[model samples]
Target: MNYTLTPLGDRAIVIELGNEITIATHNLVQSVVAFLDQHPFDWITEYIPAFTTVTIFYNPLLVLPKTNQTTSASPYEHVVNELIPYLDNLEENHSELGRTIEIPVCYGGELGPDLPYVAEYHNLSEEQIVDLHSKGDYLVYMIGFAPGFPYIGGMPEDLATPRKDNPRLKIPAGSVGIAGNQTGVYPIETPGGWQLIGRTPLPLFDPELEPPTLLKTGDVIRFKPITKQEFDSYKEDKA
Candidate 1:
């Protein structure tokens, strides 16, 4: 992985991780995070990590000496130059981190209004569709589009369905869906077009909970097909 540190001001530097975010790439992100946690860099105020980049916020007033204020040199520039060498030496080490989560999904019927349509479109039985969707391993890319919404990859190529012709006005939270070559869980109820397969009782996002997101980037996921009764049971238990 390559990194580019850009100074936002005297107080912060945004580091861009020039690599695709994957389970294999998490080590680099973790390393940078670890460094920030231990290092007493008074200039740094915040750190935000995305798919393949981390932005660092800092304060110039804290890092610069009061006496050095006489010079026209920017403290940010000085810090960037000093950090460049260290960043250049950093290796691309991936974290051995990833968790597989089994999610129960009730397909067809009211839960999956479009399941029959999808099955017919692919000239396959609905059961086959369910099996195909549930059999594969999915990698969490990033949580976006809504809170706890996990953008996952690694769906079977055959299951690469497109968005609906007419998007629904409301898609329930915990709705498992597929769009194009990807699939995801809706963290909150909102309008969406991905083919709804089932609804899980698990809360994907809860503001009151610490680390509210159920799935994080770099985690692995698997779907387990369940009957409507099973889904109902799970929901009741959760409630």
Candidate 2:
């Protein structure tokens, strides 16, 4: 329940829950988001949840008219006052548990052209790299950079590698890669600098689906290694 309120532009307020990107902070962020979702203000437009903050955007016109000090105080002040009570009362245990999703990946070869580079960088064999990556626990910290792209955390420090100096113009969807101490899958084809080590056949983003993105923040991710033949079969099954 510890936080600081800061103004964002003219009509938004940011509630910073913690200073670090730990699971405890993540839970607090989720708790705040859940509280707002269940008890939304009429003037509030939307709320964006990040690693350690929840940004609430509002309509100043609606907010200004509702405040008791309409003539004396700004909309930002009024909104912050209204939000404090609710945030203070939010229970940390109210944060929902996330789902665990298994993703099958085909490592090396054409799909993961940078696998050798990562192996060499870590001074390990390509097979050892795959084993380390596949066995590590991962969490979806946030979705950003591109639509449906998941910024994951909890990658083993042993597999850590820097991003490519020169980014690729168009990485195919489902390409899994490591950057720093994190790992993620490209939900859509886009320019990226992460060192590609594998790829999944899953269609991670689809406009036709109810939720376009396959992953959401707080979800637990498991990577399963698949053979080239198995990867082909997965695609064929989907086709």
Candidate 3:
């Protein structure tokens, strides 16, 4: 319950769980989210949790505004005052493991244009590069950049590489790329600089669905290498 609450304009309050990014901090954030999701404040509209922070979006008018206080309070202050008691008495357990998700990927060739470049840069064979990447047990730290695009961590340090010097005008949706210490799948066709390593045939984002994004914060991903024929087969099956 030791956390700092900060105002974000008129409708949002960001809960700073800790100063550093760690599993313990993320665990606390998720615990709070689980509690509030079931017993949410009537004014609250959104709950967005990241590596070590949680942002609460609420309606200003819906919360009780105090008139007797010496200083006027914004919606942020109103929420802080109302939610402080629950924050103090909660029990947060950090030992629980995240849910594991298996993702199928087709590396090299047309699916991964920069696969050779990454292998050459690392002084490793294409097979070695793929092995290093797929072997790591990656965690979904947060979902950012494009919608449903998860900013994942725990990539093998040897596979670390800087973003492209000149970013491509458009990267195909489902393109998997490594940027520094993290790796992510491009959920939609957009400009990007991450070194493209492979492509997942999985449909990551579909707005019509109840939950559009295939992944969420705290989910663990294990990449299963797939052949081009299998990737094409997946697409055909989905179609």
- Tell me the lDDT of model 3 at 130: 96
Tell me the spans in candidate 3 whose CA falls farther than 4 Å from its real position. 65-74
Task: Give one digit per residue, the lDDT tens place, for model 1 in 1-239.
Answer: 47777766556677877567565555676566656667746677777656666667767676666667766767777667656776677666646557888888888889888888888888999999999999988877666778878877788988778899999999988888888888888889899788887777778888988888788766788889889889888888878
TM-score of 2: 0.93
The per-model lDDT (C-alpha) reads 0.77, 0.88, 0.87
| Superposed model 1: Cα runs more than 4 Å off | 6-14, 19-45, 57-86
lDDT tens digits, residue span 29-96, model 3: 88888878778888998888888888999988777544554457765677998889888877877557
Backbone clash tally for model 1? Answer: 5
Q: Could you tell me the lDDT of residue 46 within candidate 2?
A: 91
* Candidate number with the higher TM-score (2 or 3): 3
Looking at model 2, residue 192 earns an lDDT score of 84
Give every collision pair in model 3: none
Tell me how candidate 3 scores on lDDT. 0.87
Best by TM-score: 3
Off by over 4 Å in 2: 66-70, 94-96
What shift in Å separates residue 204 of candidate 1 from its native position after superposition?
0.8
